[model samples]
Target chain A: MRDSLVAAAFELFLERGYEQTTVDDIVRTAGVGRRSFFRYFPSKEDVVFPDHEQSLADMTEFLAASADSDDPLVRVCEATRLVMRMYAANPTFSVQRYRLTREVTGLRTYELSVVWRYEKTLGDYLRTRYADRRDGTLRANVVAAAVVAAHNHTLRHWLRSGGEGDPLAEVDRALGFVRETLSPDAVPAGGGTAGEQEAEDVVVVITKRSTPMWRVVREVEASLGED
Target chain B: MRDSLVAAAFELFLERGYEQTTVDDIVRTAGVGRRSFFRYFPSKEDVVFPDHEQSLADMTEFLAASADSDDPLVRVCEATRLVMRMYAANPTFSVQRYRLTREVTGLRTYELSVVWRYEKTLGDYLRTRYADRRDGTLRANVVAAAVVAAHNHTLRHWLRSGGEGDPLAEVDRALGFVRETLSPDAVPAGGGTAGEQEAEDVVVVITKRSTPMWRVVREVEASLGED
Candidate 1:
């Protein structure tokens, strides 16, 4: 009945504008009673998207299954992918919902509110992971934000591109950038050496014993003068 | 008028619960007309906020002033500090606002929405600074989230502690963790020199010799095998 009501709402929403559609119109088209519509959705705007409560529950379950693992970062990536898959699973409905949401300000804010809820969940998970360290709280915030950003960046691109390409690939690429930035210390082979850290005066020399200290000192002095 | 309304709302909210307070009740207490209340605020929920619009505009001006400088990261730090100072300037109101927001679900969501707006502004500023890089978007997202997280962490701590300490120092400490995490390529002088990278391996060898050849490799490999 809920699914039928959602389908009817979207159909009416498309045939007429969202503003032109009402709860009575939705029930009339769905062949369901007014009580049924109210039972399924708190408001007309809610039928346009998936059940966020269910998705969040699924995410919580997924996280709970892997709570013993020390890798919070990897688990977050997987959790985000789980959400992407949910959207991808029903592409036609997702696309229709996205288009409808764009046309409604109230719906857009509602959508954003849902996204914020997801971010908070991720943030909470991360905060728990980093609870023991002095900088755990800060690290959790960055990691949570980065994970959500990567997901959203890919999701927006996918939506903007008419949902034509492989969204998971783009999500992976965005996540890769995040992983590298946060974990630059794990920089792999052949990616060139890591950049310098400019905290204090530090000199690095790549030379053999045949090179004299006086020449090195002269070079250092010259570099300092240039600076 | 807005100020008086806020004071009245807080007073009523404390005396009665948030759920018990209505716009009509607030206006009656403030001795303002309904038109006056509507002119100043969109809803009763908006009364407890410190001028978010004004703070957003101030942040915009702060970012605009740093357009020619190279240190955008530092500029954002100061902009965030401006927000913290505003909260600190009114400890009683902030503490009361916190208590009310915590108790009211609608107010809590509204507060999250406002914080998300702040994050958006910070992210947009960072994207401009990191525009030329491959990971600029991802970097901006992480950095922005980190700033908000750091600020929120300190803000919550202060609010919980009755706003008694120097939160500016907390912000700095949080920013330092963020900056270091985002760019982790620190090198120490006169310490162990870096070694060649491998896909599954990274070697940091401490040696007195200046030569780079089989002897060094043998020493490193022999010691590494022991581990």
Candidate 2:
């Protein structure tokens, strides 16, 4: 019934425009009681992005489950995945919701505002994890900010592209970037633990700004021969 | 005139309350006409976050000037510093503003929405830098997010502690973590080269989880001894 109401509302929004649509019009069009519309969605805009409260609750649950992990980077990654999975499972709805959000200024603000809830929740968890470290507070805040940033980046790309491909890979790679960025010590297992070695030891050799991949590889190989 | 309006607004907000204070009261206290108040500030809440628009403009200008640099990471770090400098130059005002933002829910949301503008601006510049590289968009977004995250983390810590210490050092360290995380291969001159040596000639040793620092040092010394 609620889904139908939301579907009806979006249909009306497409047909008549968001400005012309109202709660009464939505309920009337859906053939549902006014109380039912209010019960399911608090306002007309709420119907457009109804899953926020639920997804936030879902994110809260995932973070709570992972709360005991001391691995701040891993914990943040897991919390971030919760959001990605929600979109992956419902790509069509998410895509439509994305379109609506991008077009509506109020909806866009509301969407961005929802991100803060995740940041705060993650930040709180981070504060607990880093309480003993000298820079625990700052680390937690950074970690939280990075998680939200990484998640939003992936989510936005997937959204902007019309949800066409495997976003999980992009999401993992992005999170991998954040994880490595925050905790370089955890570089992939095969990368050999020069994790302790000063990161400065690794020098990147690129041919020129326009260097081709094969040439870049040959240059790297040639450079390696010198040592 | 704008400065006086802001100062007067803050003084009044502190003495009375945000809701209780009116435009009439603010202008009367600041010795400005009602028309002058409208000319300077759009609303009472607008006066609370005066530097937001200007700071965003300054950051955009800094990034625009850095577009010629091939190093995207350097451009982002410099941009982050510009933002921090804006805050550092106004510690007292920022501290007071922080207090007001915390107490007012509407101001908090407004402040957050404005901060997103900074994040989006930085993220967009990063996107342009990484436009050609496959899988680069996600990496760029994450890097941008991490940069902002690092800045916000440092800023929040300074604000939360009542602006007690030099936040620039903290911001630098946080951003350093971000740079290292995102582009470990691009380490400075002292960091090792990115070239890979012949597998047979380079016997790299990784430290065990339980290995002591002294033992790891001895192992490195022994390996060099063989060479």
Candidate 3:
């Protein structure tokens, strides 16, 4: 019945436009009463996105099942794959829905709320993992947002291309920024980490701009001597 | 007249509740007709966030004025301050609205759209700035989201605390993470970059993880010998 209702709703959304299609129109087209429609979906907007509730639960559980030893950043990155899988499960439906959402303002806002829920879930899990750190809450939130942003950008790129190719691979590359640049031992993109490194044995020498190479070598030797 | 409608709407929202309050009631309270209310705000949601349209324009203009040489990451971080300044401008009102949005699901979604717009603005500005790079669009969007996430986390902390203290200082500290960890020259936090020097000689040694300090020094000395 839920599937029928979603199908009926999408049919009407695609045919008559999302704004033009009413709940009564959807229920009537599905050959079900309005009460049955309400039983399945609280609002018309809810029908356009039937997979989020289950997907969110699945994502939350997946993160919960992760070990403490796993890198929280990587775990969160992996979790985004679950979302891609949900969309990939039915590329036809997902592509149609994506197109509908791009054209409909209400659906777009609804989509943002759904994405926010996923980000919040990731944030919550990371917060627990990084509880000991002083900026645990901040890092968790920022990383969660970054993961979602990357995931969405790549997912949208795929969707915009009519859902061709592997979204998972694209998403992995996108999420790598969160891991590579933001990781504790990150060697920043352009090399100099504006100023700090956490691990031992690695050395970053900071000098005034345009410093001579010979002087740079001297500085490295002097630092080595001190060590 | 616009100010009066906003004042009247917030007044009724606090007293009679947001859901229960209607457009008719707001117009009645403001001593104006419904048409006048719509003239100022397209919807009740617009009244709750009366400042965004103008604040966004100001932020866009600020970014538009940036020079080619300005660091784009830092520019985006600075752009977020305009948003913080908007919320900090009216602490009492901002705090009240924040409370109301937290309680109302509709308002929360509405707020999310508003936030999405700000993030989009930052992203658009960044996209133009980083257009020459291959991953420009991806970096632009991710950094924009990161800046907004950090800003909101700190802003909400202030709002949750009844909007007390210097939000600017708090936001600057929060935004520093984006600059420090994500910046091209950023030194990761902890030890290596902690001792930033103004010496004329600088070197960066990237080696295998867990490499011994002796090898790192030797490696540095070898590089100098080649030079």
Q: Which candidate is the best by lDDT?
A: 3
Model 1: lDDT equals 0.70
Candidate 2 per-residue C-alpha lDDT over A22-74 given as tens digits, one digit per residue, 9 for 90 to 100: 88888888898999998988778788877778887876776677646447668
Among incorrect, acceptable, medium and high, the docking class of model 1 is incorrect
Per-residue C-alpha lDDT of model 1 across residues A32-54, encoded as one tens digit per residue: 89999888788876777647878
Residue-by-residue lDDT tens digits, candidate 3, A1-227: 99999999999999999999999999899999999999989999999999999999999999999998888888999899899988888989999999999999889999999999999999999999989876779888888888899999999999999999988888888887556556643433233423333335545554334445566556555554454
Model 3 has an lDDT value of: 0.81
Which 10-residue window in model 2 chain B sums to the lowest lDDT?
A: B191-200
On DockQ, the leading prediction is 3
What lDDT, from 0 to 1, does candidate 2 have? 0.71
lDDT (CA) per prediction: 0.70, 0.71, 0.81
* For candidate 2, the TM-score of chain A alone relative to the native chain A: 0.77
lDDT of candidate 3 over B1-227, digit per residue (tens): 89999899999999989999999999999999999999889998899999999999999999999999998988989999989998998999999999999999989999999899999999999999889876889888888888999999999899999988999998998887666657543333222422222212334454433445566556555544443
Give the distance in Å from residue B221's predicted Cα in candidate 2 to where it truly belongs: 10
- Model 3, residue B114: what's the lDDT? 87
Model 1 misplaced regions, further than 4 Å: A67-70, A184-227, B184-227
DockQ, every prediction: 0.19, 0.23, 0.38
